[model samples]
Target: MSTDTNTVTALPMRPVVADVLREAADADPRLVVLGADGQALAAGVRERYPERYIDVGIAEANLVGVASGLARAGRRVVVCAMAPFLVRRAAEQIRNDVANPGLDVTFVGVGGGLSYGTLGPTHHCPEDLGFFSALPHTRVYCPADVVDAAWAVRQALAVPGPAYVRLGARADRVVHAPDERFDAGTGLLMRPPGRALAVAAGAGVGIALDAADRLAGPGHTLGVLALTAVTPFPQERVRELAAGVDAVVVVEEHLASSGLGAATALALAGQWHGAFAAHSVHTGYPPIGDREELLAHYRITAGDVAASVLDAVRGPGAGARR
Candidate 1:
């Protein structure tokens, strides 16, 4: 909350995650960077925290396994590796070794989802959210931008259990986190006091914010959620906020079923008591294609997410229907 609401400032450093790691290392001596040698992000952490950083070469499973072991031995380990390789390649180690048994490991998933959009299907880690969401006692973090990405790392480090953090390949425009909105599971309401709302998860927050900027009105709101950690969702807060909004549209960069929409449905089913209608259109994905194609194909862009909000307000067959 140190920064002002409207003032957007860049991090003092170029790559902000480095500062985050350094801060965590300073905060706790037991913090270790468990990384694969090939990762640029991992290499950066290794250069600075040589003593506390371990480069385990190319073993994604070993990357997570070592972290689980470290956590068991009372050390806090951040397993940094390629997004898809770390999550998909190390599925068994993550599921069985950490998530299933509820081990205290944090997988720092780099280049998640379309961040590696051009890297092909094999490199995409869109399922990380779905993977962690279903796991028992597992927490998930999908940061909106670099600031929240760094904050997410801190949040996971503080937790004494398994956490998954998925970050984009490169820096994203900063999303303001003035107060407790940046806290674990809590979401930030970017636009204040509006009848209609667009809910966003991860980088989709930026898209929602952009749409809100263009859609000027007294009754239009943009509710962006960083979701630095999920599982112990900000249920009471979400329920309270969702109840008052006229229209609610959920957005995420993952498959619709297991991502933001699913979580929002569960939150509502547990008596959300929201103004939004029961029927809604999700940012769905089933076709195997590039991220842009996937988002456009699924109508998940800022304009599309925004259009859905207006559609929800007008109903199934309103004059404004497109």
Candidate 2:
């Protein structure tokens, strides 16, 4: 579980996002970047496109409102802020202003899940997908790496309605190839074909990939389905992925109640009768710790995922262990 810099490149999602936003701004003069004291994360965009960047101080509500207004005025606006405040604190504006009118605004939520781990439950955003996905006319994205992060920015800008792109705070382990084509509503298969499939999104995608690798040594191969776009749930694609798998395990950093786990369950309900399991944080606030510690504490790590997949594939009471 060590995030060794040598083994994998840890590309921070914020800077990659800023770079992509700056490129988008260059193409369209009407595209603007708004932040709620998130200037540090969007510094690259601010420096490259000074005229298009706006910092709305600490008011998360005002941040979303300004973005909505700008979008209503025919400008493509990208609102950047910590996930908790952007999705929870300014939820009223998100629901009323952006989603209600179906404005072309992209809400970039940084530090998603436990990215702000040591900052406690107040800063952690584990329920963003549930809230945003439930809103009408809104698209939700949880990109796993830099490539998908950049692609999400482009996809959000192209969409004519509200969109939410959830990103981790620190650098993420690369999970996609440079030449990999990003299909908005389709899940990417990260591992080789196997009897079981691990469906994951956001940071959990990387974790799921690692679990697949670990399972290989035991002669157990698991397919990994990494989802970039969560809302606009991609029901047909998910059903296809689960078609012939002996077991399906849904892994995510958020709570199982309303995250990828829940979405997958809803999608395959009455369709697939194979072994189904969900690995994610259960209800309630997690104990304070760093990202790795928190993941282990909640049993959402690669080892935990591997164990869960093994149990599902081997059947209940098999007592699979990492």
Candidate 2 lDDT score relative to the true structure: 0.83
Q: Any runs in candidate 2 off by more than 4 Å, and if so which? A: 1-6, 217-219, 316-322
lDDT of 2 at 258: 87
Determine which window of 10 residues in candidate 1 has minimal summed lDDT. Answer: 277-286
lDDT per model vs. reference:
0.67, 0.83
Report the Cα lDDT for residue 66, model 1.
Answer: 81
lDDT of 1 at 247: 64
lDDT of 1 by residue, 1-322 (tens): 2122255444321266666777777787888888787545555556667888888989888888887888788887778887788877788888888888777677777777666665666776667888887888888888867667777777887877888888777555566653434656456666653655565777666666766765666555555544555556676766667666656677667765777767777777757433442122243434666656655655667777667667655565332312
Question: Which stretch of 10 consecutive residues in model 2 shows the poorest summed lDDT?
Answer: 313-322
List where candidate 1 sits over 4 angstroms from the true fold.
1-14, 43-45, 177-181, 218-226, 270-294, 316-322
